[model samples]
Structures are given as C-alpha cells and as structure tokens.
Target chain A: MTVSDPTVGELSEGEILARILARLSPSRALLGPGDDAAVIAAPSGRFVATVDTLVHGPDFRLAWSNGFDLGWKAAAVNLADVAAMGARPTALLVALAMPDATRASFVEHIADGLRAACEALAPGCAVEGGDLTVSDTLVVAVTALGVLDAAAVTRSGARPGDIIAIAGDTGVAARGLDLLFSHFTDASGTPIAISPAALRSLSDEDGTALSRQLRPFPPVALGPAAASAGASAMMDVSDGLVLDASRMAVASTVTLDFDRQCVGDDPLSLSGGEDHALLATFPPSAVLPEGFRAVGAVRDVGAAPVTIDGEPYDGESGWDPYRDWDSARG
Target chain B: MTVSDPTVGELSEGEILARILARLSPSRALLGPGDDAAVIAAPSGRFVATVDTLVHGPDFRLAWSNGFDLGWKAAAVNLADVAAMGARPTALLVALAMPDATRASFVEHIADGLRAACEALAPGCAVEGGDLTVSDTLVVAVTALGVLDAAAVTRSGARPGDIIAIAGDTGVAARGLDLLFSHFTDASGTPIAISPAALRSLSDEDGTALSRQLRPFPPVALGPAAASAGASAMMDVSDGLVLDASRMAVASTVTLDFDRQCVGDDPLSLSGGEDHALLATFPPSAVLPEGFRAVGAVRDVGAAPVTIDGEPYDGESGWDPYRDWDSARG
Candidate 1:
C-alpha cells in the first residue's frame, strides 16, 4: 500500500531515485556504482569537474529565494566552473538538506530551478541524480562535470605582453546585491525598510542579479575560442574582475596591469560574482577574437599587488562571503 | 587590503572557487558558460549522474562523522547511484554549507573524506569543483557523474518467473544505531556510564556501520555482470531490499515472491540501508550470475500484497526514511 503524508512522503529520495535510474542505460566507461565505483570512459584521459554550496540566510532567503532559484543556482555555479576550465559540461548531481516540514513544492521548485538552469546553461547536462534530506536549515549543493576535447586553458599560460580580454560583462550581480541590500538592515548599519514598489523593483533587478548570482551566465563557448585564437592564459571571472584577474597573474607568475577605463562602467561589468565571464591573456600578435573585448595586458611579476589604473584601492578589495554578508542582504 | 578572520574567512566560497577554477583547463565539448549553457560532448550521447545530500544531525554527527567520512560518503552515495546504473564513475563535484566558525580543519577533513571515498570506490573519479558557504549548521551535498559504455540496467526489465537476488549484506547500519542507543543505557533502561574501551568498541562498530550507512560500498561492477549474465532487471537496494524490490516488481508489472529463508537472519542482512548492493532479477532459465544468489521469483501481479513464502507480511514491510524516523531514536 502506498502511504503518503504531507510531512513524510511515500518514497524516500533513494527509493524514488532507484526507480528513476532504472530507466537510464549504463556506459562501458562507467565502472563502479549503479553497484560500486562507476567506471566512466575518459578517452581524453582527464575529466573536468567543479562544486558549490548554498546556505540559508547567507546565500538565499526562503521568502525571497524560491526553491527553483535554489536549484538553478546550485547547478549554475558548478557549470560555470567547468566553463572556466574551457570544458563542455556533461552531467550534474545535486545534494540537498532541509527541514522535515519543507513543502514538497519547495523541493519540486528546487528541481524546477535545476531544470531551468540546465535548460539555459548546460543543455543536455542532465540532472542525472541527487540526494535529499532534512536539516535545521535549507542547504543546496551542486557538482558539475565537464569534458575537455583537446586544448584546455589554464591561468598559468599567460606570458608577458599578452593582451587581456574578457568574454562577457561583470559586476551585475554585485550591483544586484547592492540593490537588494538597500532593502534590508545589515550589521554594518540599521537601514529603514523600503516600499514594496522599490523592493519589488530591486527584487526584479535582484532576480536578474540573483539569477546571475544563483545561475551565473558563464561564457562556456569562449574557452575554446580563446584556445584556438592562441590566447596564452585564461580563466572565468568568478570573483570580482580585479581580484580574479590578479589571480590569473599570480598563477602565471606574472603581473597583470588592467586599465580601469578599459573595463566599461556597467555595474554588471565591474564587481558582479554571477556573471561567468571568461577573462584571458593572449599574445599581442594575435588580434582579440570576436565576442571578446580587450581589457588590459600582462606584465612582469612584481612585489606590488594588482593595481587598477596604476593605483591601489584602500576600500574593500572585492566580495567576500563572510565579511560581506551585508552586501547580499537586499 | 585583504581581511581574514578564523571565525569569518577571507573570501566567500564563490570567490575562493573562482580563483581556483582559473587554474584548470577547458575542453571542446563545452558549449557556453561564463555566458550560458556549457556544451559538453557526450561521445556516447548519454550521461550517467546521481546526487545525494548529507545533513548534520540526521545523516551524520559532527562529533563522530569526521570530515573525511562526510566527504567520502557524499561522493560514495552518488557513486552508488552511478553504479546502480551499471555505469563507470568519472567525476564528482561537492557543495558544502556550514557555520562561519567552522574550523578550516573541518573543511579540509571533508575534502579528505571525499578523496578517501573516491580512492576506495573509483580511483579515476576526481573532485571536479564545488561551492562552500557559511550556514547555521553543516550540510553537504554531492553530485557524482558516470559514463555508460553499454545499455544501462533499469528497474523495469524484470518479468514473471525471474529470480531475484541481492548483493552485499544489510541491517548493519541499523544495528549500529541499536548499539549506539543501548550502550549509553542498559536494555532495562538504566543509565550507564560506559567505559571508553566499551565506547571505542561501540565506536568501531559504529564506524563500520556508519561507513555502511554513510558511504555505502555499492557493487558497481555487478551492473554489467548481471546484464551479461542475462539478468532481466536490476536496481540498487537503497531504502531496503523489500521496498526497493517491490518497486521493481510493480514497475515491471509483476508480483515477486521472496523466500524469507533465502534472506539471511544477520542483522546486517535485514532492514539495513547503505549496502549499495545491486538486487537483480533473472529468468528461471538463466544461470545466477557469479556474484549473485537467488532469493525469490517474480509472479503475476495480484490483489494480495507481496508475500514472503506465499504469506503476507503483517509486520513492518521494510525501512522508510520518513516512516522509520519515529522509531529511529531507539
């Protein structure tokens, strides 16, 4: 007999999953679990992967962040990692924990979010499998898989005199957060509540920004473009552009001097975290490829830290999750 | 300037991950991201995937469930999913959420857990990428990827007259819980301060059980073995053999009669979760696979519920995560 309770569902996640998985076929490369360690075929000999987690209050709010967004972002963040690596995303798996009473709709919405994100970010990257359970608070975690065909770009490949270019905009997510935080009071300061209209507008912006934050729009196609175009070093802009670009420099053991003016003033183009843009360094001899905008150039490594417009900033370096919780509050 | 605190780390999980991903390589199959939708080449044209979530209290204990186990189990559970599909595990990604004060060691331990499980289960499967965040409690979500070489075994292929068999033992984890609850108190309900040595023994058993419970050793190799051996249908015994097997029977439109005598009386053989064993069905004419033993046969679906030796079970059918919780405390 099938027993169903609003509090307790008839099928445990594992049981339901077994039934669902029964429909899929196994691969020769898949080695182990369906029974043990699944043996996967890595003809290229190496596979690409990335992971990300989201917590309640800090990463998302139940009131503002729906389950769909939760699922969407979870997958998005991980897929972006594969994109940064210049790999094609193949499949995705998710792990979720929440309170027992969490509405089934919420869980389904989470799936919907995953579906939506997969539809937009990694088509055919099936939500092949995942785990679900109850927790004190809601948590969503996603891991993404990618495949590299031939040339995989690395941050260390950049050389001096290589031009730095970006595949997409930046900072829109940070701006979206700025708009979001305008509504909520933070530990840094006590702010008054805004009207519903303003809140809604900010939320709408937040949705786009949050979508960027939650389901980052990564330049998955750009990795290969940069590789074929003879780009020296490449990486996705996950952190602030300035901070992430500096990372490329540090990894390559070179100094990267970026022109602040060269980076357009769009907030999304500045400090956003959700815009999965590819920033790469290429030989000056190579013309900046189409769909990529020139940002700056690589230089020799030095004792001094990364500088924008030849000046060091005394303010916040970039977005930090713990230190900058207030920034995401809106 | 960068501000770092033990309680509050320097960068958000996203920022740190972004910086790390910059160093990785990309492939040709990746379509788009850093923009939208990564294009991955599924050479076989199909992907194998699975996800599992771990909560702080229900799934594990912060004190006992060390970081390595947490990480290992997170990946192991999903790997089990792939194994169940008769696929080979390729890559894995993790998403973790925990409190801000969480020691770096704890996170590092979790990574160690992931590494250990991967090594034990699938050597080729590496952690691709994941996200971590601060939360009120710890939550870990992992997604595992697998590649299928041939057709995947599903739960729906069983037919009437097919014998059922299960790999691996069960109930060890459930008995481990019994030991845990009973050790602190005698059977008569008397409080007892157990000696550390006794506690260690219990802990050791718990470790074994928890390993079974947390990181189930799925018999991934058996997926293809069953298929090659002419097994009609197969699935992982996740919730319980009875419940999951019943599901297979119903999906295949058949009634399966299980010989209770065929099921060993070992506590580890009954009502256990996380054995990660593949329970499969084969026609009477088909020889039992090398790793498999016959437990029952499929019959016509009827009004009477699944029976053990032609007798209905008036007692508990099997374990259900939500239903079993009320009695789980014991």
Candidate 2:
C-alpha cells in the first residue's frame, strides 16, 4: 500500500502487526517476533541495555518529519547510545504508541526506516521484537541491546593527562534543526505551513543540513574499535560538546579542556546537541584510532569540571527537554 | 516526601532522575542506571526480551488509578510475560513519557511501585535503567529481560493427547474491571464521579476482585516448574482462555478441547482477559504440578482450532485493544 492509504483504525491490531512484521528481517536474534519474547544471543556473557523515548511534540514535529525520518532517528539515537558504551548493538525492541487515526502505511514506512538504519549504520543488528499500543500522541520507545567485545568504555574511566578525541560530525544536527525552524516559522516565530515542494526547493546546503538533523550518522563501528584500542573513557556527544564533556569530567573527577582553535568557527560544535559523535579520552602517549580527531585534553582535577581554551565557558550548556517551550524556541 | 507534594515541572530532568534513582535498589543487574547503558548478566548465553506500552487514555485513566498503581501494574504485566516463557526475570528497562504538569511525587510513586513489585513478586529482579521524556500524555513502556534456566517452553510444542492445565486465577481481573466500571458509571453509561472513600468501602469480595484487576499476581514460579516437569507446551493467558487457547492450537497444529465442568461458574474464565495465568499442555500420564489444575485435553487438528466438551462452543472470544472504544468499554 502507498503512504496515504488505509488508516490503522480501520484494521485489527493483528492485521497491522502482520503487515509490519513482514517488512522486518531480523538477523541476529535467535528467535524474533511472533512469540511472547524474543531470544537474543549474548555470547559475551554480559548484555548492555539502554532505552530512549521520542515524543511527538518535544522530540519531533510531524510536519517536519515523516514516518521514515522518525523511525530512522529513533534507531540512530539508541544505537548511538549502545555504541557509546563500547559495545556492538545486537538487537532492538521497539514500543510504539500512536493515535488510532494514524495511517497503516505510516507504520510500514517506520518499519522500513528502522530496517534501512540497521543496514546502513550497524549491519546485522535486528529489530527483534516490539509492542504497539494506541495513544493520543505518537511515541516511539526503543531499547537497544548490545554485547561488550572489550572492557566497557565508561565515562568514569577518563584520567588526568588523557587526550580527548572525537569521531563523526559535531553540531550538524543542531544546525539542521535551526534551518528547519527558520524555514517553517514566520518572522514572528509562529509556525507557518510550508509545502513539500517548497521544502524540496531549499538551497542544497540547507538540504544537506536538514538531512543531518533528520538522519544522524553516528559512528557505530568506531566505538568498539576505540575500546579495543585502550581508550580511557568514552561517551556519545548527545547533549553538546561542552556540556557532555563536563559530565565526563565530573564522572572521572578530572577536568576537560577543549581547544578553541581546534573547534573552529562553528560555535555550535561546542554547544549543539544530537550530534551523536563518539567522544573518547586516550592515554596521552597512545596512538589515536583512525576515525577520531584530537579536539581536547584531560587535565588534573581542577576548580571547574570543563573549560574551553584554558578558561571557563560561559554560554548555554546544551538543550534541556524540560525547559519552557518559549525559552527552547529561542 | 508525601505523595501530594511537588510537581515534576518544578524540577529539571536531572533532578527528577536523581530523585527517582535514589529510590531504586537493583539487585540483579551488573550495572544499574547512571551510565550510558546498564549491564545485565546473561550467563545462559541468551536473553529473553519483551516490551509493552501503557498509554493513558487507552490503557488506563488517572481518575481511577494512582501513580503507584500504574507503576505496579506495568512491572507486573511485563514480568508476567517473562514468566510465561519459563524464564526468570533478570532486569527491567523503563521509558516513561508524560506532560510537564505531571507531579514529581507521582513519578516517585511510580518508581516506588516498580521497586515494590520487584521486591514482592520477583525477588532479585532489578530496575536496571530507563529513559524519561516529555509528552502530552503519560506513557509507560517497559522492556523486561529474562534468563532461561532450563529448556524454553514455547506455544508450538503441544502434541495430540496432551492434557491442558492452568496455574493461576482466571477471569477475575475482567470481573474486577466490570465491577469498577459499574460502580463509576450510571445505568445510562455516563461517567459519575465516585469518591475514594466509597471505593474503599467496597465489599471484601469486590475489593478482592478489584485488586486482581489492579494488581495481578501471575504464577511466575509455576512457569519454570512446568518446564522442569516436562510440560509439552505453555503460554500466558493474557487474553481470554478460549482465544489464547486457540492461538496455542494454531501454533501447535492441534485442537484444544475444554471440559465445561472444569471451568466452573465463571463463564468469564472462558472469555475474560488479563488473568496472566500459565496455561500448558502435558502428556496425559505426567503428574500435574502443584497449583496446576486439568482443564482440557489436546486433540488432533480438526475443523476448528478449539472446542468445548467435544463440540464447538460459540461466544465472545476476548479483549482486543484495537477495538472501538465503546465496544472495548463493554
């Protein structure tokens, strides 16, 4: 069926499930959906589990994102968290809550997006199982399971004199979000409906930035590689470079110093969120992994947890979901 | 803090999480909360995973249930799914979404309910980690992980001539729900406000039924016991008995025949939902485990997937969440 066809309210739960499951192919699960539970092989003897939820109003706007984008972002964000733990994602369990009036094809497109993300970002990771329920708003909750191939690279492992490095893009998603906000809203900050054709006609640079926002490319492979390479500590740069670095510093009881010259003209690289880049600290003398670029250094425990270019950064730390909507808009 | 003190909007996400985490005591997970992901031991080399979502309007009503009740019910339902698989629950991951106006005390109570359930029902099980997000309505999504100690019992293992038995309450939750519905609504089906004191004054029998509806105690241990006892097939009766039995019959390619006398006076036993009982089929000569009572027998594949007393029995099958709201209310 096409994307605009039959609404889910017109079909039974069993039928919708059958259609969605048919579109998914699980490669890593011992036993996939259709059972009471899915069996996932955990040969490493330990499983790393993380869960994240995306709500429609706070996380995404239906006008700005389609089912495919929603599904892809959901998978990418969770997979990034799994990668940050220095593990390889093995399976994903999705629990979706949507209004009954949602189109059946929308759900199918979501499945397709999940499959595409798995194939592109973390091959062999499967959509093991999921639950679907009716709600007034759309909510996608993903619980990702991974296997630790090496010692877990926790945020608490950073030590004094460690060199900080990063893998994948930083601040791109934040830029994309800014562009979308501008394109969809009028001068007074009120939302104005924009046609799909108009959105497609935007400048190529804007289109590229929007894609980054809609579909982040987290460095899933580099996580385990860094872990194996003896990285001291690691985490995904989700909230923002400066804010997340502060978190790592506090966890490790050390101080993080980011070089302003290395961060470049993009102030966003220091404060933008949703980049999903791998941020790791390696021993000062250790050889850096291939994809990672040196951006900062770990210093001895100091008065402040994080600083930029030897001085404290006095700017917005990062995005906070609980902030008032008006303040968030600014 | 008391149950009615502070609203969640008064605190930042970090503050809320810190408060919630302080109340949780995790015994089964290798790592619980505070990191990118929680680590769960999977000594069996495999993990059984299941997820369920409870939406405010569709799955529950704040007018009738409290935060503690919501949390307890969420944990119980997911744990029951793990138990149905003949596995022991090891860890739980929660993804909660709610409006900004939600009370901090309410969230705390939910966490308390989750902790209480793990302590009381499945000792040693832990709330390993979770995600909290802002939404327009309340949604609780839980993903439970279990370890199979013995052979994993599936619904597709029943053979012809196997005796059908069940271990736990039947139709009680449905009856309890009916009682609650009748109490809160006028004869014309319009909602009428019922005071908490009046609700507390319900007859002992009615109170028992309501508790079953609000806090189901699934026969978790019996599932593993049935597996050890060499039961041929097993499943949880989450839906009504006939509908779920039909599912088992279809999976095993056998016909299930229930004796009317065995089910007794509660016709709801044959067609009610949320019982969370372990239903299994075993060889006729095998001794029934304690708590399991014979209810039927497995037969060769026939015209219909299920029958009662050697003849087809026609009645309303069971609950369907996707059914129209009015019909579902009935």
Candidate 3:
C-alpha cells in the first residue's frame, strides 16, 4: 500500500513495527534492533552521548515540512551535537511518539529520511534502535552516541588571545526561514498551501534558502577535524552566533569580540538560529584548519561576555523554544 | 521557592534548567550534563543500549501517580531492558517534554525520582545527561546504557529440553494494577480523588499491590548472574507471562510448556504484565540459580509457541499499549 493509503491506528503495533524494521539497513553495531538492546563497539574507551527532542508544534510545523524533512532534520541536529564534541557519531537511538491517526506511510517516509540523512551527512553512523509510543502529537527524541578520535573539545577550554573560527555557512537557515514565512504565509501569519509547480518557480536563492531552513547541512566532519587540529573549544551554532559565543565566553571565563568585516554584513549572522555550523577557538599561533574562517578573537575576562566591532550589541540573542512564538517573531 | 510556588511558565528555560541541574548528584560519567554531550567510560569494548518512552495519557496519569512515581517508574522500566540482555546498567539519559504550564518543582521531583531509582534498583548507575523540551503534553524518554560482564544472552538461544526459570515475583504488578483501578475509580471507570486519610486506610496487601504497580523493582543483579551461570536465553517479563513466553518461543524456534503446579495457582501468574522479572532458560541438567524458580520447559518447535500444563491455553496474552484501553482491559 502507498503511504497515504492506511493510518497507523488501523494496524496492530506489531504490524507497523515489522514494516518499519524491514526498511532499516544493517548497522555497523555489534547488535542492532530486534533485540533487548543494541551493542556498539567503543574502542575509544569512552562514549560521547547527547539527546534532543523535537515536538510538532514548537519545533516544526507540518505545513512547513513533511515526515521526510522532519526525520532528516532530527538526525542532522542530534548528529551535530556529537560533532560539536569532536567525535564520530556511531549510533542513534530514537523514540517516536505520535497520534494514532498518523498515516503509516508517513512513518515509512520518516524511516527513509533517517536512512538518507545518515548516509549523506554521517556515513558511518547508523540508526541502531528505537522505541515507538502513542501520543496526542508527534514527538521525536533522539539519543546520539559517538566515539572520540581524541580528547573531547569542550566549551571551557578557550583562553584569552584564542582565535575564534567557524566552519560552514552562518545565517543561511534563518534566512531560509524568513523567506518561507514571507512567501508562503497569508497576511494573518498563517501558512498558505503552495503547489509543486509554484515551488518550482522560485528564484535560485529562495530555493536554496528554503532547503537550508528545511534540512540544515551541519558541518559534521569539521568537528573531528577541529579536534585533531588542536581546537581548544567547539560547539554547534544552533542558537545564533552572538548568544552561542557569549555561552562559550561565559564557560571559558573570557570575552569574545567579533570582527564585523569578518562576520559579513548580514545582521542575521548574529541572531539567526539553526545554522548548525562548527564554531571553535584555537591558540593565536595555531594555523586555522581547512574550511574554517576567522570570525572573532577571544579576549581577557571583561564586563560583558561578547561584543561585535569592539562594542556591546544589545539585541535578541537567539531562539528560545519556550518563549511565546508570536512575540519572539516580532 | 518551593516546588509548589512557581510554574515553569513563570521562569525562563535557563532558570528552570539551573534549578534542575543543582539537584542532580555527580555522575560516574567522564563528563556530565551542561555540555554539548556527556562522555561515559566504556572499558568493556562494547556498550549495550536501549530506549523507552512514557507518555502521559496511555502510559501514565497524573491523577494516579505523582512526579516522583513517574520518574521512578520510567527509570525502572528502561533499566529492566538492559537487565534482560544480561548487562549491568551504567548510565541513563533522559529527555523530558512537557507543557509550559507544568510546575518547576514537579520537574525537580522527577529528577529526584530518577536518582532514587538508580540508587535503589541498580546501584552505581548514574543519570549522565538529558534534554528538556516544550510539548503540549508531558513525555519522558529514557536511553539506558549497560556493560557486559560475560557473553551477552539473547532470546534466540533456548534449545529443546532447556528448563525455563524466573527471578522475582510473577503476578504482583498486575495485582497492584487491579487494586489501583478498583480503588481509584468509580463504577464507570472515571478516577475519584481520595484524601490522604483514605489512602492511609488501605490494607497492607492493597497498599503493597498499588506500590508495585506504580514502581516495579526488577531483578537487576540476577541478569549478570544468569549470564555467568550459562543461561541459554533470557528476557524481561514486561508483558504477561503467556505472551512474553510465546515471544521467546518464537525467537528460539521452540515451544515453552509450563507446569501448572510449578507456576502456582494464580491465573494472573500466566497473563499478568509489567512485572519486570527476569525469565531465562538453561540446559535441563543445569542446576537452578539461587534466586530463580523453575516454571516450565522448552519443547521442540510445535504448532503453537506456548502451552500451560501441556494444554493449549488461549486467553488474553497481555497488554498492548496501542490497543483500545476499555476493550483491551479484559
């Protein structure tokens, strides 16, 4: 049957699970799904782990994304956390909760998306195991595990005089989000349906923006590369540059000053969310790694944690999931 | 402020997280929360991992359980899955999603519950890390990691003539659930609020039953012991005995035949669920382990996967979370 043909409620849990399991490729894990627990080789003597949850309403809107996009984004974001730690993602444990009325085909699309993303972004990583439960809305929680190539790069290791650099594009996702909001929504701020033909008519820049917003291409490889290159500190730019920089500064007990020319002219570069870029600091004498571009410099502990162009910029820091969306949007 | 004073909506996410972090004890992990990811020692070469999700509506009810009970139950169930694999749980990662209207204190109580369960049920297991998100309803997802002391035991290894045994009580959780359903609800099955005085008036048996239903204590140590004793196959009795045994039988390609007198007189012993007892099989000549009681024997692959007293016993096998509650209540 096609994905739109049947609803999950119409099938037994076992039937649905069987279909889902059949779609997954064999993982490199010692033991994969279909057992009590999955076993993954951890030759690094330690494992790096992190979890992230995405709910339908606050995290994403169905009008803006499909099951495939949702699954892709989920895997990308979680895998990015592992990359931020300077580790190679090895396995992912997913727990999905959704309403009974959800279409069974949608789940299949999600599984396909997960597979596709893992293959594209983190080649060796696999969707090892997962749990499924019923909820009033769609919720996806992913626990990602990774193996460290070296010592983990932490947020607290940056020192005064360290150089701050970034890998991958910044503000692209935010720009994509703004483009979608402006073109796809009605005057009342509600999304309006767009046909495939209409989408195909979009300008190249607009199309790229929408894709970036929908499926962030996190700099997965740069994390481990940075660590190997002796990065003192690193993190993924999920909550905009200014706020995340401030966080790094606070953790390291230092001040960060961004060079306006180096950061580009885009104001959203400092405030846009979901960039998924690798932000790292290195010793002043250390040569910048490939793919990294200098954006700022670490300074001695100052009254403020962060500044742009030698002055403190007072504005919104980044995305806050718990804040009122309407007011935050304004 | 006390837990009852401020709602989560009244505080920023940062403030709530700060309070939550202060309550957590130091974990055995190499690196704990407050970073991009947690790092845990994995000296065993291979790590066993499993995940489970608990949603408010189907998995639990605020009217029947408090935040502490919710936390305890969540940890108990996930740890049981690790035990089923004949592994010792070492770390837990929790992801909690709730509405903004939830109380800040309630989150603390849940954290306390997680700590208490780890201490009491599986000593040395730590709450390594977790994620918090906003959802329309409350949801808790836990990913448990474990270490193998010996060869991993799986469900597909039971051979003909193997003896089936169980560690821990069989029907206690089901009995507790029945008591709760009867005492906490009216004739129509709607819950009725009871005073603390009324709760205190319950008989010891009823009180014990309710507690078991709310907080199951799985036989954790017995799992590694069973592995060391050369168990051929193993699993946790999360679903009722009949259903879970059938699952084992199917996996092992054998028929499990229970001896009526050996399984006790309680009908619930055969069909009850959520007991979290360790069920394992050993060679016929092998001596039973200290905490285990022999209950059945494995037979050659047959038409049906399970039987009781050499008779085909057909009834409700166990609970299916996705099934309609009222009709499946039978």
Query: Candidate 2: which docking quality band?
Result: medium
Question: Which 10-residue span in candidate 2 chain A carries the lowest summed lDDT?
Answer: A321-330
lDDT (10s digit) by residue, model 2, range A1-330: 654477777777888898888778755688788778888888888889999988987788887788888889999999998999889999999998988889998999899888888889889898988998888889999999999976688899999889999999888898888887878877876555557797789888777778888888899988889888889999988888888889999999999998888776476777898879999999988888899999889998788888878888888778667764432453
lDDT of each: 0.64, 0.85, 0.85
Clashing pairs in 2: B8-B104
DockQ of each: 0.29, 0.79, 0.74
Please give the lDDT score for candidate 3: 0.85
The DockQ of predicted model 1 stands at: 0.29
Off by over 4 Å in 2: A1-4, A186-201, A324-330, B1-4, B186-196, B324-330
DockQ of 3: 0.74
In terms of DockQ, which candidate is strongest?
A: 2
Chain B alone vs. reference chain B, TM-score for every model:
0.80, 0.93, 0.94
Report the C-alpha lDDT of model 1 over A186-211, residue by residue, as the tens digit: 56644434446755665565657645
